[model samples]
Target: MEYITLNNGLKMPIVGTGTNTYGKENNDYNGEVKNEIPELVSALELGYRSIDAAISYRNEELVGRVLAESTVPREELFITTKIPANEEYISSKEATRAAIDNSLKNFRTDYLDLLLIHHPIEDKEQLKNTWEVFEEYYEAGKLKAIGVSNFGKNQLDDLKKFAKVKPAVNQIQINLKEPNKELLAILEEEGITPVAWGPMKTEAHQQEALDEIGKSYKKYGAQVLLKYQIQRGVVVIPKSHNRENQAANIDLFDFELSAEDVEKVENL
Candidate 1:
């Protein structure tokens, strides 16, 4: 798998499987969904070494259980989980520590590869405090990297203004439909890698172009779209329940889209 060295000196896979689907339909606490475990097993067997999860997803314990049971060693996998942005428990340092500890216990591990703020809270001061707590966790070795999610350009700038330790990555909706060039430029300037949550998201009207371009490489439209994001230096964690699709999504590094083809998708 291809890797990008984050500003914090940690290596992240360019393509990984996102576990959002596991908790989307299930609300039962302390239980694992039927397909979730098998899907994760299949993805791991298919060579996906990175797994993205969130406490908001409600399946961290299940994902952790599966990983604990898997034959893959802990060092071979990179796990990421986010603290729920709207939770009341994040306002104070003690509460934030408790929240992180709960996620750590859920994962059945002592440390996480990355931790992110699930979304931007309204109050700037509150957001800054939340980030400071993340910094605390990072310094304590509970988190390898810390970042923000769904933050606007202005919000990111504001966070960087007061942050003693800057964000390492920014997770956001960065698909072919909305690349957010200005925000991407800011992330680049700050040395933060852009992590795309739904890189394959595309409108029906834009299908033909993706298909037309993908056909030349014997790749499908979805592959073409994800490839486009990777070409732009963005990390992608695509959600898929099917094993074949999971396996196919990570097969991106094998091909390189030409500059003309890359521009074609950019203008679409």
Candidate 2:
């Protein structure tokens, strides 16, 4: 597996298994509520070293289960979770610390590989305060790296102006349809790697484009999308329940997309 070095010098896997299947209307069983423990365990066994979960996802405990049971060592895996976006949660430093503690407990890990602010919302001051707490934990060696999610350029600028530790990553929606070049450039300029969530836009709106690209590549639409992001130097976390697809997703290093091919697919 390929890795990206964060600003804090933490190496994160370029591809990961994202555990965001909460309240997903399409899935028969919700990951958080129904417990997709088996799939998570399978992902680990399949050589996935990074698992992205969140306090809002409510599946951290299940991920913890797989971590504890898997043969993989704790040091070999990269576990990431986010603080909830609730106003009350962000308003208090104590609340933020408690939230991190809860996540550590849920994941059954002594330290987090990464922790991101879930979203840019409500009180800005409170959010900055929350970041300070994260920095404290980082200094104490509890958090290896800290970052933000769904933050635009303005929000990123705001954080940078007062932030003690620059964000190591900006996790955002980046797919063929929503390339988001502006935000990505800003992140790159700031030495922040952009982690692509929803690299495969599973929604109906993007299905046609994904299919077209997939046809050209003679691969699954999801795989095409994931490859696109990785070639762009963005970390991608594409989730799937099917064991075959999960394994196939990581089998990207064997091939390279040509410049023209990249442009053709990205233009769509």
Candidate 3:
């Protein structure tokens, strides 16, 4: 697997497993809800070193279970979780500390490889305060890296102005249908890495353009889309229950999409 170094000199895998089943439109974790632990185990068995979960997902404990049971060393794996966006949760610094403490208990780990604010909300000051607490955790060696999710350029810029530590990543939705070039350009300019959620566009929409491009390389449509995002330097977490799909998602290191092929998908 390929990796990217954060601003603070931490290395993270380019592709990972995202455990976000609650707010997603159609895809449910199903009975696999209980299987999240095993699913993470499966992902690790399949060579996935990064596992993304959130407090809202309600499966961090299960993920923790798997991590504790697995033989994989904690240092070899990248475990990430986010602060929930609920008003009560983000309203106070105490709540933020409790949330992190809960996440640590849930994940059964001493430190988080990365942590993020789940989304932008009405309380900028509270958010900054929460980030300050995260910085404290980083200094205390409880969290290795910190970032935000679903934030646009202005929000990130605003945070940067007063933030003691620049965000190492900005997790956002990026797929063929929602290219988000403007935001991506801003992230690139600021030297913040982009972590793409729904790299295949949630489950409802399929881009035929991706299918057409996939035919050229004999790759699956989703694989083509993921490759496009990776070429643009965005880290992707394409969730799938099927082992084949998971394996295929990480098999992208073998081939490079041509400039012409990239343009075909880009223009589409």
Q: Best candidate per lDDT, number?
A: 1
Model 3 stretches astray by more than 4 angstroms: 22-36, 202-207
TM for every model, in the order presented, reads 0.93, 0.91, 0.91
**Candidate 1 global CA lDDT score:** 0.85
Put the candidates in lDDT order, highest first: 1, 2, 3
Candidate number with greatest TM-score: 1
**Model 3: per-residue Cα lDDT over 1-268, one tens digit each:** 9999998899999999887662233446542455534456667889988888887776777778888788999989999899977766777889889989989988788899999999885567887888888899999999999999999877887787678988999999887667788999988988899999888872334566677778878887778878888887899998876778888888888778999988877776
| lDDT comparing candidate 2 with the true structure | 0.83
Query: What RMSD does each model have against the real structure?
Result: 2.4, 2.6, 2.8
lDDT per model vs. reference: 0.85, 0.83, 0.83
Clashing pairs in 1: none
lDDT string, candidate 2, 15-56, tens digits = 998877633344434532665456677688789999999988
Candidate 1 lDDT over residue span 1-268, tens digit each: 9998999899999888888766434534344555347778889899998899998777788899988889999888899998887656577777788889998998888899999988887787778778888888899998999988888888887897889888888999998678788889988988999999878888996778898999999998899999988887899999787877887798888899999998899889
Using lDDT as the measure, name the better of candidate 1 and candidate 2.
Answer: 1
